[model samples]
Target: MIFRLSPKSRRNLSRIIPYGVIWLFLGWFILTLEFLATGNENQRPETEITLSFGVLVFASLAVFIAGLLMGVLEVFVFKNLFRSKGLGAKIALKMGIYLLFMLILNALTFPLAASLELGTTLTDEKVWEKFWRYLGSVTFWSTLISLSFHILLSLIYSGFSDHLGHGVLLNLFTGRYHRPLGESRIFMFLDMQSSTSLAEKLGHQRYFDFLSSYYNELSDAIVEHEGSVYQYIGDEIVITWETEKGLRNGQCVACFFAMRKQLESKARYFQEVYGVIPAFRAGLHCGQVTTGEIGALKKEIFFTGDVLNVTSRIQKLCKIYGKELITTQVLKDQLPQAMADQAQSLGDLELEGRAEKIELFSLA
Candidate 1:
């Protein structure tokens, strides 16, 4: 109850607020701008682009709550329902839904806004005329604003989708990788344990569905930890981050624990749906790699170096060590001192295909 949000509700509440703030600013700014540009100041000075303390506060809050509700419904309920429908239809549906939300929100909030002016938004004319005028203006603006915002935003997201990770889109456009750049990065290679058995048990289509559902659940943890998903190779996912960002606060290790916790929390759901709970073995490593754009038909950012190879080899050692999480000495040494107790040194070992041996640790 620290923020008056119950422990059970804290995570959901935290996710909603970030999206809520975006919606709040968009709604309030648009409404106020409309009033400033077209509202009749002489008729109602109090409500015409006037930012009274009570009106601004309550109006923004009402719209903000509506935004939060939209975010919750979109993420937890309606997101998956938006399937392979084409871009145009998706954009239309989103704008239409948001416009409906705005209409209802404005209906409730207008009264509060008028109260600040000691006046009503209604005209002293026939009831039907005032109603039609109010409804028309609200609906018109909501439609116009939502259509522009959602469609434009949809286009931007589509552009980003063509590239991997969040910032790759910008990197491509800016020619950031015209020359191969060497970067020190931390990588965590996660592979499903006994994936072959699980695939055979679930069958082809059902197996595909299982991975889809499992990855969807893990996505939240991935984003929360700021881990960039480098690629997905079948049941394996490679996550990478800059050395400083990944090692800072031991985020790279914490991400693994968070993902495990997330899946464990959903253990019952998986069992009921697929009759199996998925498990993963991860290997973490750090090294320098060259990054550059590759491929003509399909543009892509590729990372190449011995680091990837060594990381995969370490993941293979997980079966021998009987450990869920394994890390190279290089990565573990960079970790914060607080995490020292959690890592048990397995001593230096020769990883196959490489001449030299390196220290390895199993993270408990």
Candidate 2:
């Protein structure tokens, strides 16, 4: 049952379990102190001490149960609330809500536990006497201590959890922490031609392994070329390099072809081992894009605007035109005169959304 916890729940449990265990030990320590001080197995100590200890035990148990329930709730029920928001905001909101809930639950449990005392003398006379005397001492001190402990735990849990969650989500969303935005850049989208068919033939696990290797190789190549990976959509990888470099030297384009040859070699190796090879098609274009973090609780880096959309459209055209790689006129215009001759024009092609036809070229 514990293993069945969702990723988010598991994260919450990780934060709560350590503190909960420590408090459990502390509760036991307090009980031991009470026992040693009283020197009685089953008898109450001083009326004041007994009430104080009882309140301490009750609060400790309340905290434990509340932490468990709240951890689970945060994992499953409130998971979406943390999605799409920044790490700081998400952690703060969750901890604030959980702490508030704990306060309410602990407050309600006080009267109930007091009412259900067994065996001991807690009559109207004794109870009234104990209540007034112990109330100021036990209630104030314990509440302050519990709240202090809870705040400390919350801060630690929120800080560490937010740090990790934010790092991972940032990678998943934008593929980097510091994303450059609102700039003209060369965007490339590479996709495996028949990934669905390959997946069907290879089975889920094997196909996933193939995708892992494919993405790894592609990412390595992109990084080597000073390109940033924006995101992946199934078998497709969206990447970007600054237009200044891409246009000035055609280094990014050269890197793309070089990576293709490396991938071809990898395909041959996979074919020898698994009797199958995956083919890929890629599209490149140069234009402006807007990039930034998006979502509320589970924040992600996002790239939007025409360049990203057009790059993807051009990649789709690769499948239609039966080409390995395609580039737009924007890319051709930017390339050096010597490098420009290496590319062959495919003339103007009408894209799905654009009213004006886009000029296409094939990499030689």
Candidate 3:
């Protein structure tokens, strides 16, 4: 009987077919050797070999079909069912469960096949005796080992071959796929000011080298502050932390400033390498954003909303106000008394496309 298969199922079957053929050939070769050594030359050698080959082929086909069915069930039915857990955990769990299922199937088939009888005593004994005995003995152990090996190999291959495919599948099946659900938050955009002008003065190769070191220093600092890097635009780095984390504790913001200080020392190395030192300007603002994967083929987590736009505008305002860092009143309101004293108020300034002028401040 023909069963309709999904595209995914067809793909999985295609992968299984080649492996099944190889195992079938191996099983036939091993069983053929046993038949030749045991069966007498006067007792019709061809008939004995054919019977042995049929049993081996049937057993091999049974194992292959069981694995193929389990793989199909996993890809189609189970994958969407568990879609709440993390990807890695889900795949590991599914593989474990699949292995257990195959073991159970083998257990059931062994006894049932052994109990079945053919017409005469010789035919009955010959059909059930060695067939079930072999399956219960070496075949069972071999199948277990081979399956374990396949799982390990598949995981290793998936890590390098298609990590995202595996990741997406895992997330989808385990129900672990979550879009960022946090409140409207503060975002900081830090840029190396006049970077283009500096790059032009320095040669292309030297400028590229300086940028590499510069980005490393910035990334290290952002990570230290527990900020997620949104993206790097030219020589600028955009980083974000939960507003509550940064404004309430102030640790995140403080760590970022400390990172800036560390970069200042690193700037000396850039000066030696490219004959120019880099300066950075930053801006911070608080607002709501939707953060999730965007793009069909090349997916990436991106934050989108007015909050992101305003943060960029505030960074540009750093050049207008002649300050290293700029922050909005929203950020100031959330700051502690002592930290607030360090900020220089820039009063209200009209920003492009805004209905009202915004109150801004600079970090001293």
Task: Point to the candidate with the largest lDDT.
Answer: 1
RMSD of each: 6.1, 15.4, 15.8
Model 1 agreement with the true structure over 1-364: per-residue lDDT tens digits: 4556532255456445645666677767776676688662334332232456666687678767866776676556656566667656765677677667656766655555554445453443333343445555644465456535733443344435433543576577579987899999889999988899999998999999999888888877776776778888999999988889898789899989999999999999999999999989999999999999999898778899999999999988998989999998788888998785678999989899999988899995
CA lDDT, every prediction? 0.74, 0.67, 0.65
Judged by whole-model lDDT over C-alpha atoms, candidate 1 comes out at 0.74
Worst 10-residue lDDT window for candidate 2 reads 42-51
* Tens-digit lDDT string for candidate 3 (67-178): 5565456444674566566767867876787678767776655443443322234346565555555555655576577666555444343333233443344434344424
RMSD score of candidate 3 (Å): 15.8
Task: Give the count of colliding residue pairs in each prediction.
Answer: 0, 10, 12
> Candidate 3, which ten residues in sequence have the lowest lDDT sum?
40-49
Task: Sort every candidate by TM-score, greatest first.
Answer: 1, 3, 2
Which candidate leads in TM-score? 1
| Residue 157 shift from truth in candidate 3, angstroms | 9.8
Q: How close is candidate 1 to the true structure, as a TM-score?
A: 0.67
